[model samples]
Target: MSYELRDHTADVAVEATADTLAALFAAVAEGLTAASAQSVPATPGDRFEVEVAAESREALLFDYLDRLIYERDVRLVLPADHRCTVAEPSETDRTDESDDPDAWRLAASARGVPLDAVAAREIKAVTYSEMALERRGDGWRAYVVFDV
Candidate 1:
């Protein structure tokens, strides 16, 4: 799994590719963190978990990135070492909101150190503009734009 930062007219974009859905998410998360900091200290630090559910894959990606922003803003940390899993609810797992289209859920864990420890940039927010997520052949790719 890998991700690259691309130039944007007025922000930053990340495009990530992976052999599996979970790895793709993790790659994108790392890209987001990279966009904000020059480098993250490899030392161990506080760990946190994030969980999000959305009605579509794109929405899930948007929400996931937004949540990371919220975590950073509130906790004043730069997160790293991301690991995440994405799941689709089965028929048996459906609730009263069964009318909803196929839902996607993400559960992630990562470690963070104080933001002061890293040379950081300001990413105002994650934007829906030019956002995309899709499966290609046996692999998956995700793209996201962050407002600077």
Candidate 2:
């Protein structure tokens, strides 16, 4: 997995690539954390779990990143390590394209440190203004902009 910081007019952006959907999500999560703080703790002091569902792959990525931002803002935690899994919609769950109960489901955990422990930059929110997720030659790539 890999990510690169991109230039955005007034926000922070990240482009992440990975061999699998789950790994792509994890890379983006790590990128968000990296954008927020100068450096993460050598080891995580705590862990938090997250579960989110969306009607499409793009929306799922958007929600996943937004959830991480929400966790940081509300709980005063800095995500340091990440583990995530993406489940494809089951046959029964794929009724309509937009109303599927399991169109995309993400199960993730963020290992973090207390906010006060590290110097951080405020990432106000995650935005859909410039968000995308798509399959590439051999893997997947996602781009996200953070409202700073």
Candidate 3:
């Protein structure tokens, strides 16, 4: 796994890569976690049930990252790991579910400082502007450019 910081006008963007789709998503989520908090310690808690199936892994990656970003912005709930149900892509993308996200279980007693407490790096949005999710000879890789 690898992560790099890129300059943005308003918010910081993270560029990360991994050998598997799961790993790539993990790294991407970790990027958001790092951006939102100072550090990560052991988070003890029930598993949260989150199922997001995109039309493609590329779409899946973006939705996952954006969802995490929304959590960071709204609830300050930074997920340690997303137990995603990686499914086959659908023909039409689904970005909305008329339900509450917090309805999901809190998988752990994770520690996270309030947004104001942290040295907030403004991330305007998670961008697909330069997003890429693909398969290599080894496995899968992804890239996302967050808006500042």
Per-residue lDDT over 29-140 for candidate 2, one digit per residue giving the tens place of the 0 to 100 score: 9999989987887765778899888878888888888888888878888977999999887767554766566579899998868888899999988889878899999999
Whole-model alpha-carbon lDDT for candidate 2: 0.87
Clash pairs for candidate 1 = none
Query: Local distance difference test, per candidate?
Result: 0.88, 0.87, 0.58
Q: Which stretches of candidate 3 lie above 4 Å from their native place?
A: 8-11, 41-47, 81-85, 90-117
**Residue-level error in angstroms, candidate 1, position 37:** 0.9
State in Å the error of residue 1, model 1.
0.5
Clashes of 2: 0
Is 1 or 3 the stronger prediction by TM-score? 1
For model 1, state the Cα shift of residue 58 in Å: 0.7
lDDT digits (tens) for residues 1-148 of candidate 1? 9999999998999999999988999999999989998788887689999998898788888888899989999988887889999888566555676434467888998888788888999898999998888999999998899999
TM-score of 1: 0.91
